[model samples]
Target: MLMEELPPEAMLDGPPPDADHLLQRTLGTVREERHQAVLRRGRITAITSTFMVAGVLAGGVWLGHGPLVGGTDDEGEVLQGTSSAGANMAVKVTETEGGLRLVATVHGVPDGAACWLVVHTKDGRSFTAGSWRAHAGEVTLAGSAMVRAGDVAGVSVVDHDRRPLVTAG
Candidate 1:
């Protein structure tokens, strides 16, 4: 007698061994490659960003420290302050209609007192600009210092003995 074929009901209890686990593994490799690519891009971006920041800082420092035409550093400005260096004197050197001129003014004088304008040149010459015997409770003088490049003109308030009370810078 021929062997009777098993009924289809016998196969209904289980699935076939046809699942593609190899395909899942290949997909996992693809995902890992994609993740590595993203990491590489991020590293490159960070390096480039660091370089850009350093460049900006260096440029700023150079411009601030480098000397340029018509540019004066802090030291130069301090030396130029108040027009001269002497007693608490303040002078203004300007070019007026007559040419280079200097004007000196002093205030806070004693009531009913007087003051004089003293002018000195770097060339060992001294002259008096003008004198005022306390007018309007203030003393002021106008004088010109010899104009020389890099030269300073000083104006100072003088007392009875020609002693500088407050020298103009």
Candidate 2:
């Protein structure tokens, strides 16, 4: 008879042929491929995390120490001052048509202390440029004086009680 008609105990079979080897090989290949895919994803994640961290650090540094944040200008005159009370200041004086524009960065002052930015003239006159409550860290103040930049003798930071914190010429 034909093969289809000769199936009752005619085929070679005490048991079905073992397919364990084939199955094992197929499973092993699948496992290896999965492992490789996981490794690739892990590497990509690691690299992306590294770049993100580096970018944040770089931005922090730039904002912390850059000329814009530090209140420095190439065209403005820079003055440095310090006080016996451990306060420090850097003043950038720029000449404007109406007056002298002052940008001052002050540090080492007590938090919540009321302070003033005073511009001292060579003629022994003082003009209050700006005022603010001092914070713990660095504080930036901006003010304008009616005097010309050439007439400026110095700049000072004083407390609410007119106590001098720092002065820079």
Candidate 3:
């Protein structure tokens, strides 16, 4: 009955030596530890790669659709005017980091005519924002000036001779 409980190999020579048993158990433990280490390393690599991809995608989105120069509200204020020569003008002013940015568009201007844009403040201050040649159908011009926010009160379009052609609030 006792011999039936023992394996055929263990039945030989009163069983295997303790050294062989210890060596086999130790090798099994080492293999298990090695497998666990490999799994831990794989998990760490996967997590790091996921975070790196997410960071790159976030940065791309920020650079693509981020805020403009002065933050929101690209179109600040639009001023409409009609010149004595029947030309219609529109000017838009928006805030910027340093000062202000102005855009002027004029329609029905005579060809070869020089025109300028003037920005006026509430404190009776004026500045020539920009100038351009007036076209027959339309003329567009842009400029920038250093001024505080909410300081501008009006805008004016002038002819080549510095004559005020149109004014608007």
Give me the displacement of residue 83 in model 3, in angstroms: 2.6
lDDT of 2: 0.86
Task: Give the clashing residue pairs of candidate 3, or none.
Answer: none
Better of 2 and 3 by TM-score: 2
After superposition, candidate 2 runs with Cα above 4 Å error: 1-73
Q: Compared with the true structure, what per-residue lDDT tens digits does model 1 show for residues 1-169? A: 2335867667575555544676678899999999999999999999999999999999999764444224333222111122232324445555332323445555555545556766655675556666777544333455543344244455456766787666654
Q: Give the local distance difference test score of model 3.
A: 0.80
TM-score of model 3 vs. true structure: 0.55
CA RMSD per model (angstroms)? 14.6, 7.3, 10.6
Highest lDDT scorer = 2
Kindly report which residue stretches of model 3 are placed more than 4 angstroms away from their true locations once superposed: 1-70, 73-75
Q: Give TM-scores for every candidate, taking all chains together and pairing residue i with residue i.
A: 0.38, 0.56, 0.55
- Candidate 1: regions farther than 4 A off: 1-89, 95-100, 135-140, 145-150
lDDT of 3 by residue, 1-169 (tens): 8878987787577545797888899999999999999999999999999999999999998764435465675657788888677878888777776777777887876777787888889999888888887766777788877876599888888787877877777
At residue 50, candidate 2 shows an lDDT of 100
